[model samples]
Target: MAKQALGPIRRSFAPWDDPEAKPLIHFRGVTKRYGDFTAVDGIDLPIYEREFHALLGPSGCGKTTLMRMLAGFEEPTEGDVLLDGASLKGVPPYRRPVNMMFQSYALFPHMSVEKNVAFGLKQDGMAKSEIADRVAEMLTLVRLQDFAKRKPHQLSGGQRQRVALARSLAKKPRVLLLDEPLGALDKKLREATQFELTDLQVDLGMTFLIVTHDQEEAMTVADRIAVMDQGVIRQVATPAEIYEQPASRYVADFIGDINILEGRLEKGANGISRLVVPEDGLVVETDQPVESDAQNAWYAIRPEKLRVSLDQPADIAVNTVSGEIWDIAYLGDVSIYHVKLDNGTIMRATTANTTRLVERPISWDDRVWLTWDRNAGVVLTS
Candidate 1:
């Protein structure tokens, strides 16, 4: 099924850009250490109210550790975790106004869907009638009202995941923490569920903090992403900013398929700079250049931005290179061409397969010219 866009409401939501906006959740110099190893280094971050934030990184990168600290499962070795202007120090997990949904779904084997969703309310000593009402509301919200009587084992993986989500939302926590919520689903199901999850979040108007290692998952569902590496946050920005104008090479390479070539910077007028990559025999131009006195820099461009053509480019002075197609990968909707340049550098280019494969113009071992506009790439001095 096709999905609708988040529209102007979410598109215009940028409370972080407002100076007077107070953060709903704040990590003030937070750190977590395990004997000889540091899991989460000293860090400061803020999550706004009703915002969908993602902590994205590889394994052992402290994304989970940081989320655990926020959920009150682990105490911060150094700083404090604050929620709504109050310190959460010594607050127990169950007592705090936060709910966590684990990756495994963690549903009870014998309990029905309704029972699982109503369990938390019952634990808090809510009335039986109120629990029933809340469970029904939650089931309807997750579109599982008809399956309320089914056991966890009776439901499919996607259905079980929805039950877990309903249970997590039953108590209505101020902030919902999801630890790799969709990691168990198949690729197609996971991609479809990403849109559904986004829609659900928008409907509830709740603050969601999801910890994920999948870059595409983070990019698709998060309002902002914090890229972590070695217990340190490398960069935090919107998906477009993170992809188009990464603060460092690590972030640029970590988020997507980008070609980063080492080069020496040559300054030019009007904020344009030329990067002479001697080792790759290429000269790339970037329209956006930050104030950096370092002469050595890196030029980064995504595969989708590079255009592949059989004829030589009109302007070969910059942002153009001649290469031979070493390999081609047809990915249904698009094709990836691995073009080996004259200097033996494998540059990848992505082209949309708008027509049938039989009508394709470029083929294997074909000599091609790759070109991009001056503004298509970014210059990184780090």
Candidate 2:
């Protein structure tokens, strides 16, 4: 199903770039160890107020350990965790001004939706009237006010997740930590909920830190994503920057479908750099400055950025490769074509299917030329 229409996902908040803006949460040289295994390496990270930050990594990459540290469930072996300029060293999970929503809904199956949302408020010794008011507000915020009387078993997965969200937000915590909150939902619901989560975070003006292995979910909802691997952060940037200008080869391949070519950078006559790959005898001129002293580089290009043509273009010196169509996967919106070079290396390219039911422009075993602009590829040294 197509995604539900939602508000623009542009990043309206950029506190990280502002020098005067104070960090709402700071992890100073944070490290966590379980027995002899290091879960989180010594790393420093700061999250700004009211920003939706995502910790994205594969399983066993320490993303959850970081989130647990923030929520006070697990303490870091080294460094201090400061929330709003105050240390959260000894604060218990319940005492800390943060709420967490686990992958499981954790809703009360026997209780009504309203009661489930009001449970935390009542635990704080809030008056009955205030508890009702907060519960009503949270339900309305999650669009579940009409189902306040329904039990957890009576609602759908999405609804139950919303109830869990309402409960987590009812206490008005300083930050909300989510651990794979949408992992229980189906694909369509998960995609729709991503927009809703972003909208809710913006509407509530609350700080949200989510731990997720889903790359597309992070790109859709977060203002910034910290890509982690092997107990250390690889790169932290906006979704576009992280996808387009990956800091390393691992990050480029992890974020999306990427085609990487092992190449060598030749000495430049002017400021422009030239990288040559001997496998396909391809040389590309790039305006991007290469460091004076560097070795072992690779060219990274997204499949969508490459253009395929029936004949070779004039610019054979750079960014041009002709290969036979080795494979083709025709997705509804776009077609992925695998072009095999002379060196038996297959490179993937995607073309948009703009017309409905048109003749196949290019077919299997047809020779085609693939080319990209000078700046279309990123040079990765590490």
How close is every model to the real structure, measured as TM-score?
Answer: 0.95, 0.95
Please give, for residues 1-382, the per-residue lDDT of candidate 2 as tens digits: 1243334534356889999999999999999999999999987899999889999999999999999999998999999899998999989998998999988978988899999999989889999998988899899888899999999999998999999999999999999999999999999999999988987887777899999999999999999999999999999999999999999999999999999988788758676787888666678777778985336688899999999999889767677888999999999899999999878989999999889966888999999999998899888888
Cα lDDT of candidate 2 equals: 0.90
- Model 2: worst 10 consecutive residues (lDDT sum): 1-10
lDDT of 1 by residue, 121-149 (tens): 99899999999999999998888999999
Please list the Cα RMSD from the true structure of every candidate, rounded to 1 decimal place.
Answer: 2.1, 2.8
The total of clashing pairs for model 1 equals 0
- 151 Cα displacement, candidate 1 (Å): 2.3
Clashing pairs in 1: none
The true-versus-predicted C-alpha distance at residue 173 of model 1, in Å, is 0.4
